[model samples]
Target: MLYPIFEYFDQVLDIPGTGVFRYISFRAGMAALVSLIITITFGKNIINWIRNKQIGETVRDLGLEGQNEKKGTPTMGGLMIMAGIIIPTLLFANINNIYIILLLITTVWLGGIGFLDDYIKVFRKNKEGLAGRFKIIGQIVIGIVVGATLYFHEGVVVREFTNPVSIEQGMVETPAFKDVKTMKTTIPFMKDNELNYEKIFGFLGDSATPIFYILIVIFIVTAVSNGANITDGIDGLAAGTSAIIGLTIAIFAYISGNAIFSQYLNVFFIPNSGELVIFCAAFVGACVGFLWYNSYPAQVFMGDTGSLMLGGVIAVLSFALRKELLIPVLCGIFVIENASVIIQVSYFKYTKKKYGEGRRVFLMSPLHHHYQKKNIHEAKIVTRFWILGILLAIITLATLKLR
Candidate 1:
């Protein structure tokens, strides 16, 4: 909203400072700053409201130190995060841009699902929250919506380098490129990094390829969203880790949207994706600001509300920038958290079936509680996990040049 107003001031009235909004960097900075301000300024009130409404978390006896203390902390603080992100985005981004529109939709859609889950847990007194199948169904529905929009929307397209220019061949100029709709995505650490979904279905006709692509989309969305949801078991774990991931993806979005950067990096150029930088900026700011209250000895918990939206935003942002394939590295914390649960459950079930007694894997699941079982301080565990997330984020960025 503010973007168009500034544009009119700059273009029509020839205002001096309003022209700065034309720069994505400037707008992104504003978005980040605004989002941070919103989160920090309004966060306490939101938490107080949750507390006043008796919307506190129902903590289970996990046997970890300090676990019981968090029993009645106000929950569903994710509303603050959503407000921070959405307000800044609406002010700084081009609302008509398809990518921006999709991201906003992803935020609201998954946020609504998570809010519902949190609602069920707090208001209805259902510790189980929303049914697992229903949660999955919600994710799948959004996945289909996102996948179908990207596949069929005319605005969603990529520019491929058609003519190659090699320095060794004495060609001083860069290659020419053309815009075309494609199902291709960037693969890490590969010579020709682009992989098209159509080629994966070479045996089938072109009509069948989109079906496979949509299925892949659904799988990724569901997996990453759930991974984030599970990772929220500890304070500051999900928000801090997701902030790092969001920053890394924002870099990818900037490069993919810039034609010069895309050519130099030998990556696919996606037009209008620069707008995503603003969204990602808001995302990073929201997460970091939320960390103020969400950190160790937390005043509030984001519950499933924040976790689901965080993962969903990252998934959709990556898909828009063609960096979905890098999610394993970028979201390594969530991936390992998710894998730990899967492995622990599978092994326990197998052992119970074979020996008629359940065998444990880690002292607890989700990876973080394992450290807690080892008597590690919760704050220390969170810090180490955040450091690891930062390392993974760096490695994810390095893939652009490594290829």
Candidate 2:
């Protein structure tokens, strides 16, 4: 909304300060600051409302440390994050940009699903929350939407360079550019960082490429979303890690969107990728502000309400920039946490089937709980996880030159 006004002022009236909005860095910084103020200032009031409504979390006998103490903590605090992200994006971003529009839709769509789950848990008092199948269905619905959009939308196109440049001196060796349709994504530490999805079905030749690409997109979206949802097991852990990841990706998005940076970095130049920085700015601010209450002895829980959206939004952001393959490294914590559950469950089921009895894998499933089970202190666990997330972010960025 503000973009047009600033653009008009810059393009027509020749306004002095309004032209500042032309720089994505300036706008992103403003977006973060505005979102922070909105979330922090309105935080207490929203908490009070949640308290007044008795919309508190019902902690069961999970046997984890501090489990009983968490009972009755006000939840549904995802509203804070939503407010932080939405307001800034609306104010600082190019509202007409397809990427921004998609992000807004992603925020609202997944937020709706999460809000419904939280609602079922809070208002409906259904301890199980939204049915697992229904949540999965909602996530799949998002995957389809995102995948179809990326495939069909001309605005989501990518520019490919033949004989791509080396990562040395942090720069493309040969630049023969073409607007080619391919299913490539960035992968770290490879001879060629590009991992083409179409290559997966090499046996099928040309016809299998589209199917392969479509399936890969769906798989990535679903997996990334579920990874984020599972990682929400710890307070401040998911939110903080998300902010770190969002910030890192924002850098990538800016570089990718800028033709100069893209050429210097020897990477694909995405025309509209820079617009993602504004969306991610809102994302980072929302996570940090939410942490004000979500930290340690959390005042309010985000529940699935915020977790699902965080994951979905992150997934969509990466897909938009054609950087989805970087997710395993960028979101390593979420990946490990998710993998722990899948491994634990699979092993337990397999052992039970073979031995007629179940077995445990780490003391708990989500990996963070394994530390929690050792009485390692939740705050410490969350902090250490964040440190690892930072390291992963560094590695993800370092790939620009690490090759």
Candidate 3:
């Protein structure tokens, strides 16, 4: 919202400081600062309100150490995160940018779903919260919308480098490039990193290619979203992990949006995607600031509201940068958390059917809980996972040169 007014002041009125707003770096920094200020300043008040209103998390005894201490803690603190992110983005970002528009929509859509789930659990007194099927349906719907919009949006175009002046010098001086819309994504550790989705479904003809691509988009969105939700079991785990992931992607978004950097790095130049840097900045700031209260011996929990939106934002941001294929490596922690749960469930059912007794794997699921079951301190487990997340983020960023 503030972008246009500042732009007008800079361009028409020749305002000196207003010109700084045109820089993505400046705007991104401002967004992060604003997000941090909002989160830290108002977060305590929000927690107090939630507590006074009796909106607390209902903890179940799973026999893990320090498990029962979390009961009755003020929950649904994701509202603070949402406010921090949205308010700053609106003030600092280009609201008309297609990528920004999509991100805003994704935030509100998934946040609403999460808020409803938390409301059901806290207000309606339903431990089950929103039905599992309903959450999946909501995620699927948003995935379809994102995929379809990216596919058809006129603003979404990539500048492909047809000739390189010098691969060693990292230059793409040749003008043999064209900005076009294509269904391609960056694949990690490949000499020619671009993977076109059309080639995967060539046998299905042009008409079916888009459909297949959309289906793939839906699957990725749902998987990453749920992975983040599952990873939120411990304090500071999800928020801290997500902040790392967000910072890495913010770098990718900045480079992808910059023509010079994109050409010099031999990466696809996604026109106008640089605006996402503002959104990503706000995201990282929100997560990190929320950690003030969300850490060990938590003052508040983000509940489904924060987890779902965090995952969805990561998914959409990656998709916008055409780096969706790198999600497995970048989100390794979330992937393992999600896989552990799935494996535990499948194995228990199989064992019950085959041997008439349910067998267990890892004492508990989600991997982090397994450590907790082994008498590991919750704070120690969370810190270790965060270190792992940082390592994964470094590996993800290294892919740019690794190829």
| Candidate ranking (lDDT, best to worst) | 3, 1, 2
Task: Give each model's whole-structure lDDT.
Answer: 0.91, 0.86, 0.92
Q: Report backbone clashes per prediction.
A: 0, 2, 0
Q: What does each candidate score in C-alpha RMSD?
A: 2.8, 3.4, 2.3
Specify the highest-lDDT model's number: 3
Pairs with steric clashes in candidate 3: none
Clashing pairs in 1: none
| Higher-lDDT candidate of 2 and 3 | 3
TM-score of each: 0.96, 0.93, 0.96
Q: Which lDDT tens digits does candidate 3 get at residues 155-207?
A: 88998757653444665455576789888889999989989888889788877
Q: State in Å the error of residue 219, model 1.
A: 0.7
Per-residue accuracy of model 1 over 1-403 as CA lDDT, tens digit each: 9989999999999989999999999999999999999989989988888999999999999899998889899999999899989999999999999999999999999999999999999999999999999999999999999999998999999977777634656546666878898888999999989898878895799678878777888999999999999999888999999999999988999998887788788888898999999999999999999999999889999988899999988999888888889989999998999999999999999999999999989999989999999999989999999999999999998998997
Give the Å error, residue 48, model 1.
0.9
Native-structure RMSD, model 1: 2.8
